[model samples]
Target: MPHHLIRKLEHFTKLSCDDRQVLGAVASKRRTFAEHSDIIEEGNDPSHVNLILEGWACRYKQLDDGRRQIISFFVPGDLCDTHIYILREMDHSIAALTPVKVAEISRASLDRLMDEHSRVTKALWWDSLVGVAIQREWTVNLGQRTAIERLGHLFCELFLRLRGVGLTEGDSCALPLTQMELADALGLSNVHINRTLQELRRAGLIVLKGGCLTIPDLAALQKASLFNPNYLHLDREGRNLDANEPASD
Candidate 1:
């Protein structure tokens, strides 16, 4: 094992080398999922918790009537099953939105980490709470924001999250999202998404070309989304953006 997973954890919390190795002991590379692959079937017992090492995925719930609603999307360094432990059976299905690399951390591994270091366990649990808060924020956005605001908030989220993983630079990044995907995330029609994107461009906030985001004004963009870091629970041993971003260069 490359033990690269520990690198992500090293920044978020204060783990001793031994503790780091212990956690790494349980982490192993998972099978890669192709774009649109069904990762976990709804109503199935989740067998293991997975940490995203690469790419994007979405969790969604479907109704008997055939309507589907996306609940959350996982980015790099986000736990694919951080909340799945409490799930006796998955209520929703997860799908890879792009080629995705995951790391499987078995339940036994999680139990061992929790037993060895309570702080590590607490930090991981806090991640789940933050996940809930994000879903709540999305609900508020969908209920109140205009299509433009909704889209802006989604963009803000992408920038911040990618920043968290040290993947952003000078207000620009490779953002491979289609208009239809944006529409699904924002609960709007594709036409509405296209119109809002144009409005964002007109405002000198953002531009999309060649599947890349050119954010001319990151500060203004964050303001538009009411983006807040408090919900992210920055106390983890690793994945600390502030502690990592400035040093990334």
Candidate 2:
């Protein structure tokens, strides 16, 4: 089976056969969750870290009044959080947005892997930093960008990310998010999300239909969103690690 984690890590640094084998073993324990189910709830101690193998999930914080703010979306190849075992309890919850499959890696296994493979450990660290960077960018998106701009930026980010993991087909990718979900993620009301989608459609910048998002012109969409791919750090930050390993076939 194809491993999205390996594909994602290879974006930053080449992985050796040993590294791949270890990762495959780590990911062997798989579980499935139905849509809208809580994978990990707030205030609970988690013994294992989740590696998303399929479908989408989100980190969200809910208020006393039942309002929810989505913090981040996890696609295939995303780790829910690294070193999360250090926390006494989760501050927020992670839930499945769609039918999800995950590999539950125990803390002990991860510790052994880190101890044995320095390069793999560093690559995981890089992945964690990229998650932080995306969080920062989302803060800016929510606090500064207009509703349309925010949507455009999000679309651009998703396109690039799915592309990185080989999920995108040319200019299109599966969105699988409802307008209500988009509203929650972007901090907009359902009506506002619908109107923004209408605007984007009218401008011919995007074509979203049947759970698929297609950017007719990526450059124009990026310009509209004022998106800078710099925050993503997709440029092989862990490339130096490649020097230590033999060339991969």
Model 2 residue runs over 4 Å out of place are 237-249
lDDT of 2 by residue, 91-171 (tens): 999999999999999999999999998778888998899999999999999999999899999999999999888899989
lDDT of 1 by residue, 1-249 (tens): 313334434445545556656666766657789998877889889978878778888888878997667778887777875647667898789888899888887877787778877656765666667778888889988899888778888788777667665778878876877787777777888898888899889998898899889888888987776766566555553544444333210
- Choose the strongest candidate by lDDT: 2
- Give each model's clash number: 8, 0
| lDDT (Cα atoms) of all candidates against the true structure | 0.73, 0.91
Clashing pairs in 2: none
The deviation in Å at residue 51 for candidate 2 is 0.4
